[model samples]
Target: MPVESIHGRGATRNATPTRFNLQERMAEGDWLDQVEALDGVSSRRTSVTIEKPKSILTRNSSPDIGFDRSINAYRGCEHGCIYCFARPTHAYHDLSPGVDFESRLFVKPDAAKLLHSALSRPGYECAPIAMGTNTDPYQPIEETWQVTRSVIEVLLETRHPFTITTKSNRVLRELDLLVPAAKLGIASVAISVTSLDPKISRTMEPRAPSGRKRIEAIRLLNEAGVPCHVAIAPVVPQITDHELEHIVEAAVEAKAAGAFYLPVRLPHEVAPLFRAWLDEHFPDRAAKVMATIQSLRGGRDNDPNFFSRMRGQGPWADLLRTRFEKAVKRYGLRQTRFPLRRDLFTPPEGAQMRLF
Candidate 1:
């Protein structure tokens, strides 16, 4: 049977088995099967499950990534972006990395409390905490859950430095908290705009804010004295690659502090899911798109090396870098990194005192 694209959803199907081989297949009467049956008839409604984790802060020592620690208030994004690199994480829960990764969501209600506890530890070091690294902190469900907002509240109370990366304009809703934090040189935001065209954005990102809205968000954030940058992440080869110059120009017009981009990456189960998305939405150029991506990824679905993973190696990668550098220079947009201050960090009240 041909994989039918679900309405208002990015994944064409949800039965893509996880890479862990935890289960052979879905049971006959599983709710996922019911979802598959209602594909064309009705849209799949988003379902949120509350999660209480012991610790809210995640520490990573990857040399490529700038941040040393991060926090994810939610797992499994609802934005439904087909190229999301975080999709494979759903496999840990025995969930599909496809539609289930988007519709069946998880929110950490105790994130703020746990974060407060972590910051109060005597050995805790001050560093920028990155939000929306694994899942968007501002995904639609945030309106009700307010978990991300709660997490921010803790960060603000402790006077800790942090950064947020999201594609939704909803980050504007937190300007009340962000403004004061920015004044302290402890808060910054990066808005990801994958494509400028509404049609492409609708099918590609599905639930993310429109490109125009995101651009406006950049303007608003900068005007509010909060530093904002534009991120053209996962720039699709044949589909959205043509908009690189235009996107940079838009970022300049919006007064973005800086802009950066990365090529689409397909690792683990994401490879098959992305391929299915390409066939459903861009069948004509699917093969060409994969070909270009392989060339950028060194003839593989993905490059897992440290530096090379972040910065592709082949000629195509070089060309992308060259074009991006020229565009930033021509548009007069600074590509310089924005440094967040750690000196201003103050541990939460009741924190254990350190003795030299």
Candidate 2:
């Protein structure tokens, strides 16, 4: 777990799959496999595979989740956030959730088409569809793939309401669409600012937009009449917990509409990957951080309880909430939700078709 080895990656190595797959690679017997893998087989090269999903919008009924429908243009994220809760999902694809989750990506190139098809369905509802809830819709590959932009185009044409939560400043590229959508009360964006410290951000997210860039993006988006909020996510105890107030202050300074924070949750394979990251970077304070995290989670790595999951119940959680509540009040960020236009929704086939 050398610093030099993990320079470009978030997790130093890929973890074993949690679920058994037909083809599994065991490093125990094959020294040649290790040799081949180490010899530049994965020297920071990105691999993008096409995912032909039958549908784009995914519906979830988790009580704690804010939105019911969402679209993830990509299966894995290149930003390489070590503590990402979505990492374990890679197991279903017969892939490792650690490094492989970041390197090997699956892009749904036909997402926009599928979304239109879903919207065309007779029983389709007009509720807002969220994007970037699972994987970031705007990643490095997005510049080339442009899948997210296409999806937005479809939404715009259909007059659909949607929200985007992302950590990438690259979302600025779609300002033309977002600016108009915001005016129509159809769109809003939230950016995650984990730490104001550039050093911590680099190690934590690896390839995500810098803290400064995300703050600036918020400022620009808000200036352009778009509702922009800040999310202080996965506030790692003993590591990033100290930066809570500072991040909120910076977000306010950046003109963020409002702000919210979530305590770090290490679910499934994410625990080991995050532990690996801790051992490599914050070795000195790893135990204390985990101990604090456990204290917040009822002596476990995670608390999957519905309401408490988003807002941990404890003194530490209380402190985080206090700081956030005070910060939002001090900044005078627009607390009232900038509601999206669900009523303005029109079917993909237009008014004449809706008349039927």
| Most lDDT-accurate candidate | 1
Per-residue C-alpha lDDT of model 2 across residues 59-140, encoded as one tens digit per residue: 9999888789999999999999988999889888877888778888999998887887888889888988899888999889
Clash pairs, model 2 backbone: none
How high is the lDDT of residue 332 in model 1?
97
Clashing residue pairs found in predicted model 1:
none
> Which ranges in model 1 have alpha carbons more than 4 Å from their true place?
1-5, 25-40, 351-356
Candidates in order have lDDT scores of 0.87, 0.83
TM-scores for the candidates: 0.93, 0.92
Question: Model 1's lDDT to the true fold?
Answer: 0.87
Q: By TM-score, who's the top model here?
A: 1
Q: Cα miss at 140, model 1 (Å)?
A: 0.4
